[model samples]
Target: MNPRTVLVLGASGLIGRFVTDDLRARGFRVVGAARSLAPAQTMSALDIELPILALDTAALKRFLGKHSVDIVVNCLGVLQDGPGSSTGAVHRDFVARLLQAVADSGRAVRLVHISIPGTADADRTAFATTKREAERLIAASGVPYAILRPGFVVAPSAYGGSAMLRALAACPLDLPETEMATPFQPVAVEDISATIAWLAARHIGDASVKAVAWDLMQLEPVTMAGVIKQFRHALGTAGWPLAAIPSFMLDLGAKIGDLASTLGWASPMRSTAIAELRRGVRGDPSAWIAATGIAPKTPAEGIGRHPATIQDKWFARLFLVKALIFASLVAFWIVSGFIALFVSYRAAAGILIAHDFPPAPVDPITIGTSLMDISIGLLIVFRRTAAVGLVAGIVASLGYMVGAAILTPDLWVEPLGALVKTGPAIVLMLVALLMLDNR
Candidate 1:
């Protein structure tokens, strides 16, 4: 621990945070990395023992050059679509770049990566593929590496707002007689962390420096039927009932979760999370435990160790805030565009009336088309195109609203406030268009 530095990516994550704390307590100098500065600050302020690093893989080489890291731990994972979302290109590309940087740096003792338990033939989900690819990259890096795959990480109560669980709890129904009899094997989060901490210290047989693995949970195997019963019992939902959803129905549910996940700023259930819940994987952690001498803890012991408790309501709140901001921007754009269009119409009308020029039939249709574009703007409210789309929205709304206020009827609103609020968005679009033209 003296000169050995451990670099943990995605340090703000649940298991990642636990692993960081575990390593830091054992006297290891831990350098933690996350995409955002807020969580980094929280980790630093709470645990002064660990230093924080921003998750910029391109900067890894420069950062590592300043500090000597013995092992690089990749605990950065997601269940969403991409890097910041679930786990997509952001995860895959970053791992690839980080491994490449580590190889070039010629420093670091080993690369410890966290992997979900599965082979190539298992789940073809992007999560499995990205993780498998990450593992392959590290193993091929000529660096010593060890992979740990844990089983169902359990918590005592509601997880991610656990609305479904709550719905079950509140119901007056009969419990699912079949699921109450199934098996389950859960592992404590700390035990999983400890396994990594121990394995990081011990270099077992063959000295390959890279160990591919399946963490096989340390619990008496329980069935899904039993797990549901336990959940009901735990929640005091005695009379509540559950029907064994067919595998096809379960897959449909997952697809539904995925399809609508982006509608809000935060989602309680990621699309992929459903599949993980429906399917069970159990393995023997004996080799890993025996090799490192770190036993897996039971779910009862580890559930409370996780710190961050997410609720569905929180996701809803975040979505509301995001939606509000988006809606305001769109409103701003619409208002401004209408003002501009009305001004254009008045100028054209005054000229035509003065000269006795005829009006074109397309004028009304042009205004109508612009209005239609504004409605579609909401489709991209939570997407990357939000900012630009807002500008389009402003154009659409302002075009119609101003025309209605001036040329058509008596609808009054403060033009000054709309102008001030939406002016920046219009300018942003101008700048973006210029950039696009230059490109």
Candidate 2:
């Protein structure tokens, strides 16, 4: 076992989770840190949940000193600036503070920063520019560091853009012709962890391993279409006929994704994601291969290592359906409320009147319930309160069902079957609640 301890920031992320587990398996004393230690968010119970981006230099230094950290793996990143994320704060400012903390800690701590591929000139969005700025800061900081740029990381567990790819492949859909032809090199998550483990094995004072930046990816040439084909083959959908989706539909999806982001949903179909997808993944991994003597696994080898199981198929199929489910639930509640409140107030109030409710209390009860329905819909629109909204919707639906059964049981026998239909809606809300956790 390695006596030196390592700290992994963003330990709950797609890459960080794998890296942390890999290092621990390799006998390194690993401390995994993330913004949330909640069981639903974190991969393991051992992870230290802390607001890493919010910490200043002094606080970070103190944290490093307390843990006796020998190596720091920074996997923290954001796709775009939205409600709770800023590219500048996460990619640039945090790096600056982290570098300062390493220097002030006065420990021989080696920093392993996870970054993206492509040169600064091609950096179009804040995500790309801020990442480039962080790379420059690390190089200039004089800290013993290694900036690793991984291309199209293909992990066993998918999230964000990777998950999007899986969903597309399962549905047997391809991007536009131009996008399909764009270059997209891929690397396995295992290779990334292996490289980090290799670096950790060397002494920090070893000059050859320190202060290096390398692009990590397979040498094979691959396009976006080629990558999707690999996934299709893995998922047993290669023979399925693919429908060529128009570019405008993609643009509209991105716009919808941007709106979802403002509501605290970290959707992968946002504008920045589309722009980067257009740019495609590009990098040179020859230097990395020669330096570490680690042969990166190609997409085929990586995906083939574990055949797609029933669980994998279920996840891929449900990925997009989850969004649709939430959308329908939101619309269901809101529209129902709107019709009762504005379009059919007389029809809604008359039901209560027919049940022998007092004229004064009837209107108040109808208005209050209608507003509550709208509030539930609004709550479900935001990611943070989605679970609460789903639960409230379910409870409200049940309340209406019971109230109808008691006051107007004949309504259940009505040809429209409105009360019976509420049962399915409640079930849908339960499903939404179950699928609410992003991690």
Candidate 3:
């Protein structure tokens, strides 16, 4: 086959990075893209010089046409974000879009799609929903695509150092008295990628360069706890500390992710990651291994050669945790400010009413003034010059309160209510400004 050029979407992700490296090492040209600058910068060290393209369809179409690539290795993944938004979109949607774009070109391309194993079952998981949907779209498009469904991916490099392993590496490893039966064989990326490269190029007698899902199971199904131990031992560290990141907590974390996103924080509480933590997920890769006849890398072996891998991951995780703490502080301040505004406005309103029971229109100018204040107040989120924004927010809020007070002179609620109403915003503002100035 000609020197095949491959495009990998979500190429900056865990699996996507591995796949891109694997393809490049085997002498194939690979172009990658991910919606993150950190990962894009990190990718440059891999010795693979492919430019990171934007994952947008228009950009991709232009690239594909310009490059005239032979294959499309779609490591595309999604975590519940919409087309351009991030709440309702899925990987499958992106895959479907990619497939249609390729199919319409009439250039008969080979597709290597990396899908999660459980995605085969359309009923169980949301990730699966999109993966399955993407697969369906690919199949229906009459495209020659090979699906690689990897099971529990255990990175030996992640042993004692991975977030999962670290979470479990600090205490007495405990197994549930009643464990569910979600068996899995954690397969390494190298094994899965090798199989994909082989399959993408190998045109079978009747396979038509397109095959169904390749179940890239490790050797056997590993229970959730067992894998945790595997990671603990892999890290050469013991006394795993079990952090039971509950589903509810995961959802809560996801909610908080909105605030985190401002600082370029990726959602750690992925549904799939959470699902694995909860009940465990599994896959059978017998068909995959048999077809390719390749031995998968054990977690221990990979980590042995690359100890820094474990160390780097650990450090990165700690850094992110610190970032999250900073985010939390910012979020608390924002919420407190919102509450202050609400309380202040209500109290001020109460004092203004004297006619019969309630007061009447405060007028559009007053309302607009209040809204403009709130909007400008939004900028206090910035660390430097935050005092200005806070002052603006507080003054606008106070203006609303004072305006209400002027309107109703005989209302029961007194000046105390107004003070209390503005207390949080004022206190928060004063303290934050003082801290900034002291620094």
User: Model 3 off-target regions past 4 Å?
Assistant: 36-61, 82-90, 119-122, 155-162, 165-167, 170-184, 203-209, 240-264, 270-272, 276-279, 302-313, 316-320, 331-439
- lDDT, residue 283, candidate 1: 61
Cα lDDT, all candidates: 0.55, 0.91, 0.56
- Pairwise TM-score winner, candidates 1 and 3: 3
Looking at model 1, which ten-residue stretch has the lowest summed lDDT?
A: 430-439
Model number with the top TM-score: 2
Name the regions of candidate 1 deviating beyond 4 angstroms: 1-3, 37-41, 45-58, 80-91, 155-184, 203-216, 228-253, 264-271, 303-439
lDDT of candidate 1 over 7-80, digit per residue (tens): 77766665666677778888777877665433333555323232222335556776667667777778777666
Q: Kindly report the root-mean-square deviation of model 1 from the true structure over all alpha carbons.
A: 9.8
lDDT score, residue 392, model 3?
71
True-structure lDDT of candidate 2:
0.91
Q: Model 3, range 1-439, lDDT digits (tens) per residue?
A: 4766776666655677777777888887776656553433354433233433335566556667776766777765654442244322446556655776786765767777877666444345565566677777777877777887776665422311144444444344443433323454567767767776786567533464466777776675566555555555645554544444444555665466544344333444444444544544566667766777887765555433443345544543453344343344455545554543565666433433334333446333334444565455455555444567656755765665575566554332664564445556566555544443210
| TM-score quality measure for candidate 1 | 0.60
Error of 1 at 82 (Å): 5.4
TM-scores, each model vs. reference:
0.60, 0.98, 0.63
Candidate 2 lands at a TM-score of: 0.98
Residue 288, model 2: lDDT of 95
Looking at candidate 3, the ten consecutive residues that score lowest on lDDT are 155-164
